[model samples]
Target: MNRRIVLSGTGLVSAYGSGVAPYWDGLCSGRGALGPARRFADAPGYRGEPVGEVPEFDPRGEPRKSAYARAALAEAQRSARLPVLPPGALVILVGQAPAPEGGGQLDGEEWELFGPSAELRPDGAAVLHLSHACASAAFAVALARTALAAGAAPLVAVVGASVLNRYEYASMDVVRAVARTAARPFDVDRDGISLGEGGGAVILETADRARERGLRADLTVAGAACRVGGKLPAASDPGAVTDCLRTALAEAGADRLDHVHAHATGTAQGDTAELAAVTAIAAELDTPEVPVTSHKGAIGHLLHISAVPALAAAALSLRTRIVPPTPGLTTPEPADRVHHPRAETPYPGLRVAAVNSFGFGGNNATVVLRRD
Candidate 1:
């Protein structure tokens, strides 16, 4: 049986600022936030490239990842405005673990931070940490949907965070994954992704549960599905992504999808593969071409936690019925089936939208959201 889950509220901290408002405004305004990595310029083996760093975030307090998680959680709880939840509610953190040598543990610290947000004892609460690479947040949402459907928890909070630091930057640079210039997704001359720091949180509950409390949802989690590529290491298979999207849309009972929030991060293979998958979906459905938008061009890739802000922007788009542009996309690749909006575009009165997130090791997740 399919259960209906609803999105109650959302919170975020991004390179644009510390709130969802700024993040959404930046997306709608089509302004890129990437700049020089001043702190890393003088460091050993510095690549002297641009990256997105969350302003005022200090890297010394490694465990302070909880700070970002907690701030977003508190704001989400406040925005939810629902009745007090049961003591056994669940909290899920979707993020990358600081290297063991970095002397940081994100799961425990995030739980400690999110625990206070609930009105009940922390001991009985269920806390789960998910590390599925870039698809982490999408997987987190899928888990939350399952928990709510099973009645295992009346409320669930999913938080994701990934901060850029010298260690990780150097690692990506060594592999030529870091762009030497700017972060430009889907551009002909795009080199690679610009690492960005920050995170986002979302509050969710079953639709029936929300109605029981006289609350209305901002968006509904129509459905979510994920798949793993059977290909070689650290690469995604377009076939896997296509299968994932088909299952996700079927799960959502959607025949007409209005927008696609792609996971394009300026990598040649990643962007091309994702666009191919999307184009296939369109051709199979025989629907009009889909307008796609990727936040990475403007916000930079947040690694394990990119889906957080992606979902936040998706929710805003669903409510507003507008698709934000791909900041640096000038030429449409793989034909016009995948529409890249260079400016804010209005939807054709459709309510369903899809958000795709792909991770290393061939992990791909697609979520279908509906507004109504």
Candidate 2:
């Protein structure tokens, strides 16, 4: 039906704090939030690695992931002026498989979905769970748009959360993916990811419905594309990323992008591959100087829910016409084609922005957003 979908509201709870204001401010301030990880301090094999942890979070007898989801969802609905979810509204819960209890590898049956869907979904509401590693949230956004276009629901609320837990932290530690200090995306001396925990939510609806409800619709979900490269879990393929970005741009009918929210996780392989992909796409589109930024440097890698914060940053950039600086980025690796800004910059021609999210097992997704 070619229905037009728009982002009506967005909520974020990150290492900086809850609410969009704090998150945006922290990003724009150009300071890394990586600090000592207290969550796993006393656990065996703990090595005092740094992490971007949410402060003062108390789950209060509920799963930390569920608590984060509920907080973010509440803010999103309130921002949309939706006191109650409309009947038949679809809720997409995006995240990774819960950390195994008491250590040891989890079996297939232990991979059941977890989130706040049980508490948030209203009567007649349908719930869907997506666990595509780091790209889960971006994939969820794309699915929500599709459902709305197909008239399967009047609206969709996509909520995602990834809290640092013992088993998951140990897994990354075992692989040496968790940075000893901080994540420095695009930097030549970059090491590994500073894992973070938080939640994010976005409300999407048709432009017609937003207008009918007298809600502002300034950002449009212009395009989305997801792909899988047959690669190892920890490796990234530049070719796959380039293909995904090209398809997303094609779907958006955009020839040039003003800004690119990158998925650089500070790993040597991941950052290099993403840069190669962006360089190729920039050359193909003749936007060689497209500004590229990554939130991982500021908030650390949020893992499965990382895309939500990046998407929220893209939406805010589109609205403000300013690109936030990449925190922890100093002495960026030489890039001949694209500009990686270390300071906040204004993009007078800002209109279209792309958010990239790459996950374990070569899952890649790109979402193109347009300012209306």
Candidate 3:
């Protein structure tokens, strides 16, 4: 029997607000979680303005954590508590290492960026740090599906959390220049991406278990795939991205996609590559009208927590039937204009959606989703 993979629950933490309602409210209000930099004490020479900083929560050390990682876990656990849960569950995936252990100065971008942090703990549950950069969370979701299928764990939690550190802020110029501060999927002025930090995780199980516990069985994780983009290296390359999307579509057994949740970071190269992939896919058929959007325009890049927002966006599409508009896009990019959808929430034409993500080390992952 084929195991049914579904998204049971998700908990997210970001600058928009710490919980789901806050995130939803921000989205509805056309507000993005962007603000001045606080990642480091002294970010010399770097403007380091307006990043997606997860609000610092410290209830007099009651939680014993202060960074993004702890906030993510606590919120996830809290969300799980409200929902029905199966016993003897396991934490199979962690978006990145614990923040406290890796926490350090906002000093020179190098030490901060290349600094050694995020390690493993013996007492911690079987943990895998899925830090393939931006696609980290997507990869974790994929891992959860496999773990359940292989019987490695009955109940698995995939947690993804990220924070805008000093080093990351320094890299923003490159990102901003590419997406033009507007993340239009098929828009022309796409400059690059904005940096933000947050946490989003899922506690998942087989369809049978979810049914028994009366959990929300909203959508099924139909298919997923991973690849090393070392060959592509740049996040803005068409060949590898096209390959990644094709593989994901194939694994999901989907020939036609209703929509695409683009990994468009607004960077020139990234946009070019993603558009190339979409065009390639579209060309295979008579014509494709799949509309594409990116959450980055609103939330900034969630780093390791990237997939969670994609999950949130996808979930919203599946639940409410309304596809939110692409925020901040003044003009749709020529690259992204092919067969793009222009409807808002309750997008009448959505069925199959693909979520694409890419990370350093040439890591790319694509997930195909469907309403269960």
Clashing pairs in 2: none
Clashes of 1: 0
Worst 10 residues of 3 by lDDT: 114-123
Cα lDDT for residue 74, model 2? Answer: 87
User: 28-77 in candidate 2: lDDT tens per residue?
Assistant: 88977778877646655567877888888776756677788888988998
Better of 1 and 2 by lDDT: 2
Tens digit per residue, CA lDDT, model 3, 1-372: 347877766777777767766776666455566666565436553454445666664524222112344455556656545232345455644443444443455333333233112331113346555567778778878888888887776667776555555545555554444232434444676555677766666666677766665766657888888877555655666778888778877887777776778887667677777877888887774344566777776777877668777777777676666666665555776753354434464566566778888876687888888875
Overall lDDT per candidate, in order of appearance: 0.76, 0.83, 0.64
Q: What is the clash count for each candidate, in the order shown?
A: 0, 0, 27
Highest lDDT against the true fold, candidate: 2
State TM-scores per candidate: 0.89, 0.93, 0.83
Candidate 1: residue 245 lDDT (0-100)? 87
Which candidate wins on TM-score? Answer: 2
- Candidate RMSDs in Å, in order, are 4.1, 3.4, 4.1
lDDT of 2 at 288: 52
